[model samples]
Target: MTTDLVAAVDIGGTKIAGALVDGTGDLLHRVQLPTPAGESADRVMAALTEVLGGLTRHASWSRVAAVGIGSAGPVDARTGTVSPVNIPGWRDFPLVEGVRATTGELPVTLVGDGAAIAAGEHWRGAARGRSDVLCMVVSTGVGGGLITDGRLRPGPTGNAGHIGHISVDFNGDLCPCGGRGCVERIASGTNIARYALAAGWRPADPEGDTTAAGVAVAARDGHPLALEAFDRSARALAAGIAATATLIEIETVVIGGGVSQSGEVLFAPLRRALREYATLPFVRDLEVVPAQLGTDAGLVGAAAACWSDPGTFLAVGAAGN
Candidate 1:
């Protein structure tokens, strides 16, 4: 069988999604399972295995030449180990080895979710034309990766460009990652809802919706507390983006994931906050925009990150190796 596609896995705090992606960056088959993030490491691996099994059963599996995993990190690419902060059970998890065992020993490439998103966006999405860019996913946990000098630099340990973990407040709440006032502690979807609820905000549909999405609805309805929650998240996000821009000179930032879906409720304040933080002349022109790839950024980027030839990313159609 002609191997023209890859098995792509996108691992986040909330979900473990998989896809059979062809060279054209199209997902021929997709599957997903909620991450048992709070469960034991074995349980999390089971969820990941199920998602991967779904793809292996697809007819296109024969065309899958490799496996690409884009996971939440602090990942050690050198040793194929991962220590994701949000998933407490996984400390130094041998993800690549485990994946290889599940995929019939196919070649596996591991990269941080942020790096994978950056790879996908730089390949075919929002950051396509930019040499210096930051692609972020603002979901249950905030994460980011960088594109610098027209290359996807995931860093040696696959932990570079971790904007979400960057400290934004010196005397703020302690984060799950053992840091005080990290951007993810304030700007992630989980934190957004947590903060809003703590402020006595009521969700529009509190029965089954107390998430950031619920808060977004209330914010749109002009609820002060909901608005304040999103604004606070935006402020932290903006500060982190600005700090990254100031350090790396990245000109554009692509924000995606669930929180970014809140539309104007998030972007409006984010843009406004950017003005307050990104005041440096060189960083002033930094542009923050929504990701074009939407939810597929992670999967597509996983495919892109594993491409045998990096130039394959520029192909809009059937460009896999």
Candidate 2:
């Protein structure tokens, strides 16, 4: 019998990537498209359909068994309804059924973007051999996924891993989630710039703004304000990670995305802060490292989701007699 092919799609705030993948995590027929900003859900669906059609037409796969989607937040994975705050048009949208209908009756799996990343890491990335790990994406926004005992924990409807929203400061900035002191409101790239601006690091064109990478460069070049901003963000992230480590006793924390590109600039202070905060000696040694798969993580993760059996995405390490 011929091997089954799966279609994996990862939808982010800026871009959408999809690929045809085999069970062994080999991705083929990759394609990418810009996510339509401020468009209605139907229009977004149209965009997805167009891209999927192009991919299906170009790829020479005999049979497509399933389609898996890893979408931005507030998605109900059980019902497949996506209500992401970033995607205004996606309120209560039946994403899995919608994709299924669009693809003509193929099985569709809808999962939170965080869960997808975790699944990807579990299947083939940094946490491949581990049983408990946290996969974090620190980009425009900070997102997280949890895999405990090698199983994906999506919480209720795959939205449980909103680590960015965890309150780091009691009297800090107000968040979109109606909370104060959310980690994302402070440490996300957007907030990093916001904090930098608040500290008087101004550019000629404020609207054009500085990126996390640019800030890292400026910090390395001896910009005091940028260095302070990075320190503050790192402190917040480390605190969050320490708290997670304490609560869950995680084995590893895998970080990915744009901010993580800062390399040691981001990791050093984070490690320092985590060490300072983690009172327990065991939690202090929790491995924190950059993601191995890089940009392909989302695609690889989506494919992992496609191959996973629902409610049992976790893998158990083999028992030694």
Candidate 3:
């Protein structure tokens, strides 16, 4: 029997990746290009076009039944528009229309990267077989998606599970999203490094590294300030996770991205802090695990968004809340 396929696009500030994905969530033909984030919107579109162009050249393209897009957001799935903060050139950009135009008007599904990640995990990764989950990526920025009752809930605006911007410290620091003490402000890799540096945690080597990975190494080596930074980030993340569980009763949270690669450094403190914050009986059993799909999650999930049963993609009525 011939395998069916979907064309998937994962778009972010730094890169545009496209793939032809099979029904089993496997990528067949993949292509990538750097995103000209600082350039004009047309330039970014051109890059996306190039990615789509490459995918269409593959022989498997003949089997592609639909096109799916997972974009750095805030995207309005309702209107097929996107406004990613990192990609300033795409404020309310017509991403769905653009992709449709690129692929001969094939049916296209657009979702936030976070939502896409959640769908990927639910379909084939750590959250597989689960009915309730929260999937997150904690790298340059923090992003998240939700699975409620086994369905991918994109909400009205396609940003339903945006745990990053949710305020954990209302009076703390101001977030770029105009919120104070957002989870992203305190828990992202960028914030982890910033906090460690500001707390007098200098890199081991003067000319070495100063990124979050550097801080993780320092923390493992017993740097007090570096350890403190990770602890703080873990605490903030725990609070956000607990809040989400409190609201919707998720069973597990799968974390991905560069910062999550810190492994025990991040998870140990996170589990400890979760014990303190997730005290409710119903939420106490929630599990926090590492994501299994890694970087391919966005693409796979984008394809899943197109291929999963229609009932699984139904929007939750109050998802926007």
Candidate 4:
């Protein structure tokens, strides 16, 4: 029997990854390349084209039924375009069209990276079996999505449950997104490291270990400044999660990404702070947990997006669950 597959692509600021994924959420064959994000739009597309070319040359390409792409976004599924915040060259770039052109008539599905993570978690990861969920990626930046009524609701612009940019403070520092006291401004990995450094939390091995992971290690060792930084970031995340729950009544908040790798350092304080902020009756019972898919969430979620009716060039969505 021939195994059916979906070609999945995950495009982010740092990397571009693609895989041939089966129905049961397994990545069969994969390839990765650093993204030329700082290059011209054509140059970036050229790199993406090279990725698809690799997939097409694979022996299993014959069984591929569809193509799914999850890109760092402020994507417009309505128009089959993307304007990812980190990739400056691709403002309203016709990503769907470009992919379609690459893979011929194969149906392509496009969704924001946040929405992609949501679909992945809801379909098979931490938020599995939950009808309502908020899946967040808290790495160099914070991105999130919503799953409601047993379905991924990526919304019109494919950036619906973007809790990262939600204002948690009115008189706070300015975020690059032109917002004040946004969740990303406080809780992202970059901000976590930034806060620790600003507060004189130097790492024991100061060569290149001053990142959030280093902070986590220091926090575990009882460093006051490092612990304080994680706590502050957790507080901001708690506020954002509580706000989202208050607005739409999500059942679970699934946290993933680089910063989330801190395990207890991030989750322990986040749970404590969530209890303090989620005061309302309905929002109080919200469960916060780790993501099961780890780094594969984006690729798996991209494949899942193919099942959604996000109105790409071709309407066939496989949702290979």
Candidate 5:
């Protein structure tokens, strides 16, 4: 008997990853390629094709029942399109149509990367068993998704819980997304490093690495400026999380992405700041936890989307042609 499977695709700014996932969320086969982000839209599509083609060539491809995609925002599940910020070539690109054209007859499900993360966590990660939760990824940019009443809420455009663009401080700083003092402006890895650099925190590495990872090391070693940068980021994250919890009454906030890996340097101050912001009675029990799945969360979440609703976004008959 053939084992049931789903083709999961995770499209980010840096890479486009694909995998054949089993019902139990185990990846049976995987393929990945760099996302030609600076190239034309067609070039990006070619990269996606390469990844999907590799997955279809696997021995287990015959068992694949559907395809699911977790793409960078803002994705319009209703319109089967995507407009990722980092991938400038794709502005309302026909992603679902392109996937359907490539795979021929398999149904496709589309959701923003953040929504996908939330779905993955709700199914098997830190948000497991929780009905109301918020999942965030604080890397180059801050992205988030909401799970309300035990259901993933991707919103009409698949960009529902976009906490990154939500302004935590109306007058703090102008965000590229045309918002003032957005959470991402303060808490994202890029911003963290930028703030540290501006505050006189120099990297100790001979190569002069200024990434958030470098700053994390400096913070660990008790660098005052680096620690202060993280503290500022944590405070911003706390404000954003608190606002989300207060508005939606979420019980948990699961954070992933590179910056979240800083552990105590970020979470310790985040918890303290959360206390100052989330003062509502309904939000007092909120908890913040690290994401259980690592980089594989997006892939697993994409597969979970297929397993949950095979034809939610694309027609089932559009695959395998």
Candidate 6:
């Protein structure tokens, strides 16, 4: 008997990564493709087809049972349509069905990128064997997903994990969502750079937008402006976390993504801010840690979604069957 394998795809603004993942979450085969910029949905799908075609030719066809996709924001897992803000021309595109058309009737699963990360962590990373966990990706934006009572909440339309939209300050900066001060508007990678720019923090990468990672590096090197920038980001993130903890009381908050790679530069200040602001004693002790899977998380989580039955998560799938 052949072991069942799942093809997992992680689609981001910069690139698309795919892997053949086994039941144990081991990557058997991997492929990377540059995501076309400013292209129509058809062109982007063509790029994906090229990569998938190559991967399928190399791997055993009999063992591949499913295809799983983890895509950026505004994706509906049930419908498998993607409408990422960063990726132009992908408004409600039939991403899962498009990929499935190439897979010869194999089962295809779709999930929010942030939710996929949370599931990936629970499967093999920081949140493994943990039920109540809030996984956050503080990279290009501060996105998050929730796992509560040993169940992953995809919510209606699978858009439940838009933690970035959570408001931190009622009268603060106006968000793109037309709200006052959303967590993303203040603490996300894009907004962090925006704050740095407003504060006149110049960088050697003049043409490039000064990112959160750049600010963290500058702070590490004792740049006062960068230090101030991180301080402000930390405050906003901490306040958001505190509010989330008050509501959910999760056991841990796992932080990942590009900006989170700053290590102590981001975590230390985040913890300090969290401790200072978190009013509840229970919320203060909520462990904030780095994600273990690193870059492979999105793929792994997508695979996990496939392993889960339709409209169900891993735990429920396992028990029901």
Q: Judging by TM-score against the true structure, name the best candidate.
A: 3
How well is each residue in 1-321 modelled by candidate 1, as lDDT tens digits? 788888999998889999998887888999999999999999999999999889988988888887888888888777788888778899999888778767985777788889999989998899998899999989888889999998788887776789988899989999877889999999999999999999998765558579999999999999999999999999999999999999999999999988999999999999999999999899999998889998889899888887635634221111111
Colliding pairs, model 3: none
Task: Give RMSD to native, each candidate.
Answer: 4.0, 4.6, 2.9, 3.2, 2.9, 3.4
lDDT by residue (1-321, candidate 2, tens digit) is 453677888887778888887777778788888988489998888777776876678545455676778889878776678888888988988777767665775667777888888888888888888888999999889998888877777676776567899999989878988999988988888888888878988654556448777787777776889889999999999888888888888879999988999888888888888878877977867889888888787777776776545333221111010
**Candidate that scores best on lDDT:** 3
Writing each residue's lDDT as its tens digit, candidate 4 over 95-123 gives 88888877887777778899889988877
lDDT string, candidate 3, 1-321, tens digits: 353788899999889999998878889999999999988888999999999999988877777777888999999887888898999899989887777767985677888999999989988999899999999999989999999988788776778899999999989988889989999999999999999999999997998679999999999998999999999999999999999999999989999999999999999999999999999999999999999999999999998877547423322221211
lDDT of each: 0.87, 0.79, 0.89, 0.88, 0.87, 0.79
Deviation in angstroms for 75 in model 6?
A: 0.7
Worst 10-residue stretch by lDDT in candidate 4? 312-321
Regions more than 4 Å wrong, model 1 = 57-59, 203-209, 308-321
Better of 2 and 3 by lDDT: 3
Q: Model 4 Cα displacement at 178 (Å)?
A: 1.0
Using TM-score as the measure, name the better of candidate 4 and candidate 6. 4
* Regions more than 4 Å wrong, model 4: 1-3, 206-208, 309-321
Model 6: which ten-residue window has the lowest total lDDT?
312-321
Residue runs of model 5 more than 4 Å from their true location after superposition: 1-3, 309-321
Off by over 4 Å in 2: 202-209, 309-321
Backbone clash pairs in model 4 (N, Cα, C under 3 Å; residues 3+ apart or in different chains), count:
2
Residue 8 Cα positional deviation in candidate 1, in Å, after optimal superposition: 1.0
Clashing pairs in 4: 306-317, 307-319
The candidate, 4 or 5, that scores higher on lDDT is: 4
